[model samples]
Target: MSLKAQLQDEQKAAMRAKDKQRLGTLRMLMAAVKQREVDERIELDDEQVLAIIVKQVKQRKDAAEQFIAAERQDLADVELAEITVLEEFLPKPLSEEEISELISAAISQSGAAGMQDMGKVMGVLKPQVQGRADMGAISAAVRKQLA
Candidate 1:
C-alpha cells in the first residue's frame, strides 16, 4: 500500500484504540502530507513521505532539546513520543561508519579539495543519503573531511 493508505489505516487503528495522542500526531502528519500534495500538485511517493517524516522528526528533536534545557520535562517527553512515531516510518538509518564512508566517496567523486568545494560535495551527498542520516552531522563530517 502507498503511504497515504497506510497512514489512513494507522489513523483508524489509533482512533479505535482511543489513542488520542497518537491519533493527533498522525493527523498532523497526514495534514502535512496532504498540504504538500495540494500545493505542489504532485503525489508523494514513499520516499517523499519519508523525507517529510524525517524533517518532522528533526524538528521534534530540536524542540526536545530546547524543552530539556528549559526544564520542561513534560513537553520534552511529548516531543520524544512524536519522534518515536515518526521514526517508525523511516527506513533503517545508516551507522556512523557507513555515513563517513559515503561522505568519503562523495568527496572523492567531487574532488572537493577544501571547504570551497563543500557545496559540490553536498550536492552529491544529499540525494544519496537523504532521510538516511542526520544531515547536520553529515555536513560536519564533510567539513572535517575537506579541512
Candidate 2:
C-alpha cells in the first residue's frame, strides 16, 4: 500500500487501541500533508511525504530546545514524543562518514575549490542526498572540505 493508505490504516488502529498520543501525532502529520497538497495543487510522492516528516521532526527539535531553555520538561517530552512519531516514516539517516564522502564527491564533481562554489556543490548534491541525509549537515561537510 502507498504511504497515505498505510498511515490511514495505522491511524484507525491507533484510534481503536485508544492510543491518544499516536493518534494525535498521526492526525497532525496528515493535516500538514493535506495542507501542502491543497496549497500547492500537487499530489505528494513518498519523497515529499518524507520531506514533510523531516520538517516536522526539525520543528519538534527546535521546540524541545526552547522548552529545555525554559525548564519545561513536560513540554519538551511532548515534542520529543512527536519527533518519535514523525521519525517512524523517515528512512534511516546516513552516517557522518557516508555523508562526508558524498559531499566530497559532489565537491570534486563540481570542481568546487573553495567556499565560493558552495552553492555549486550543493546544487549538484541535493537531489542525490535528499531524503537520505540532512542538508544542513551535508552543507557543513562541503564547507569543511573546501576549507
Candidate 3:
C-alpha cells in the first residue's frame, strides 16, 4: 500500500483502539500532508510523503533537544513520543556499511574528486538516501571521503 494509505489505515485503527497519542500524531501528519498538497496544487507521491515525514521527525527532534536544554523533560518526552509515532511510516534505516557503499558509489558516479564537487556527489546520493539515512551524516561522510 502507498504510505499515505497506510497512514490513513493506521489512523482509523488508532481511533478504533482509542490510541489518543497515536491518533493525534497521525492527524497532525495528515494535516501537514494536506497543507503541502494544497500549497503545491499537486498530489504528493510516496517519496514526497516520506520527505514530509522525515522533515516532521527532524523538527520534533530539534524541539525535543531544545526542551531538554531548557530542562523541560515533560515537553521533551512528548516530542520524543511523537517522533516514535512518526517513524512508523519511515523506511528502515540504512546500515553504516550500506551508507558507506552508497556514498562511495555516488562519489565515483559523480566524479567528485574534491570539495568543489560536493554538490554533484550529494545530488547523486540524495534520492537514494532520502528518508533512509540522515543527510547531514551523509554529507559529512562524503566530505571525509573527498578530503
Report lDDT (CA) for all predictions.
0.91, 0.87, 0.96
Candidate 2, 114-142: lDDT as tens digits: 99999999999887777678788788788
Supply the TM-score for candidate 1.
Answer: 0.89
Model 3 clash pairs are none
User: Sorted on lDDT, highest at the top, how do the candidates line up?
Assistant: 3, 1, 2
> Each model's TM-score, in the order given?
0.89, 0.91, 0.98
In each prediction, how many residue pairs overlap at the backbone (N, C-alpha, C within less than 3 A)? 0, 0, 0
TM-score of 3: 0.98
* Tens-digit lDDT track of model 1 for 1-147: 987789889999999999998998899999999999999999999888988998899899999999999999999999999998877777788999999899999999998899999999999999888888888899999999899
lDDT of 3 by residue, 5-111 (tens): 99999999999999999999999999999999999999999999999999999999999999999999999999999999999889899999999999999988998
- Give candidate 1 misplaced runs (Cα > 4 Å): none
| CA lDDT for candidate 3 | 0.96
After superposing candidate 2 on the true structure, give the runs of residues whose Cα lies further than 4 Å from its correct spot: none
